[model samples]
Target: MSSRSLPRLPAAPGTIETGSTLKTLLDREAIDCLAHNLARVHRTLNAKAFRREAREGIEPLAILARGQHLAKVLRRHLPARYEQAVAVLVRSLTPSLSETEGNGLAGFFYLPHVSFVATYGLDPAKNGGRDPFEASMRAQYEITRRFSAEFSIRPFLIKWPERTLARLREWTRDPDPHVRRLCSEGSRPRLPWAMRIPAFVQDPRPVLPILEALKDDSELYVRRSVANHVGDIAKDHPALAFELCERWAEGADENRKWLIRHAVRHPAKKGVKAALRLRKLAAAG
Candidate 1:
């Protein structure tokens, strides 16, 4: 979500593609398209001003920074009430992707929407005494279906750990693979291009349950995230990661074996004997 999703890593900062850059994703045309969607959903939005402000000095900003920029512009142009404003962003989302694979860069269009929630979707005390927790959760749920809420959901985990993790537990069972992937990807202790969750890096127990539920997920898209999340755990708690991988090794399927291998690959490369053995076992499986 910060830049892109799994399988499609975000473009390198200032990465130029055939003379076009990643920031172009939020260019004048993209801004107009975004303005069109928001205006369609909320009749009162000042689309013209939104475009002008969003475009002003936006060219030099990197991809994620651009998202934050437009999000702030949204504050100026949309409803003052957080709930009403978030509702509009949610409703403005284009049709959800039919399948999670091979989506290319189409999902990046909604980056600003999730950025809106992440930057402003925090404590009401800072925001005129109106709590945004419930609305933010609902907004991320919808946004993850289209783009990723992985980047946006991290702040919530930092502010409301127990509350956010509880919501993530429920999301493990969501019908959509993207939502399920967010549950793992969003909570990783060291998610790339996103802020780290210090609590999980210090003690990963809370995140374990969520990963356990998704260890053998029906979709490889979700399960691959589980593997990467475990790798994050390995960085801090190798023993815990190895133990979890050992458990997963029992009654393992081919997909799960892959997860175990991916989960321990980094540690194995670093000469962790246990991880090496585990990787070998997964290979044998």
Candidate 2:
């Protein structure tokens, strides 16, 4: 059936506007669109079977489940080796988002691709290739530019903490704010809806430097993630979060100051004295 045949797409008229459930973003049109694009980039893809598998019983799955479903189907249809499959997915991406905001649900089109990396791109030899880790990293760098691999990067961080954090340290200076943001957002100990990084939740010091590196990011988008990361830290390690924020407060610019305030907003709401003080000091700028 064509995209127009979807039961829910009618509410948004073949598009997901503000109020539509995120699940609706992965409707039949999305699967068809994804399949066609993958076929477009990799001429050898079995687009017919891929589309059929993607649609079968797909209507009942939620947003993330749909993504995983498509990724599973993609693994069957794409090249067996992980690296080649990732190369095709990277090429299939339309383009890097031009702006930081207001792109809307269009970017969610790449959710399945993100899921593809998380679900299948973790190991090298398991997926019939060498260097799948770095290959997945490169794929995420490209994918995050369009749709955010924040969720995808978590498994790598879990399985390969030292290596993933090392890569994230290097990405802290990336030109794209999205990649920069991913370094912090993907590592959040208490990232909602995403899996928890138990290590960070237990001892957040390891992720501190990432937050430090981004405390003064030029883009508010990146800085916002930085703020939220600090907030996540505060939940489990309040003193550590305060220490870093206090140090950051030394030479903080208005933007940085705003970030600190935002970071402590949750604690301040609870009347935590330390958080309240930080909020007042940074309230103006």
Candidate of highest lDDT: 1
> What would the per-residue lDDT of candidate 1 be over residues 36-62, giving only the tens digit for each residue?
777776888777787889889898898
lDDT of 2: 0.85
Model 2 superposed RMSD (Cα): 4.3
Error of 2 at 201 (Å): 0.5
Clashes of 2: 0
| TM-score for candidate 2 | 0.92
The residue pairs in collision within model 2 are none
Worst 10 residues of 1 by lDDT: 3-12
Off by over 4 Å in 2: 1-19
Clashing pairs in 1: none
- The C-alpha lDDT values of all candidates are 0.86, 0.85
Model 1: lDDT of residue 81: 77
List RMSD in Å for every model shown.
Answer: 5.4, 4.3
In angstroms, how far off is 217's CA in candidate 1? 0.5
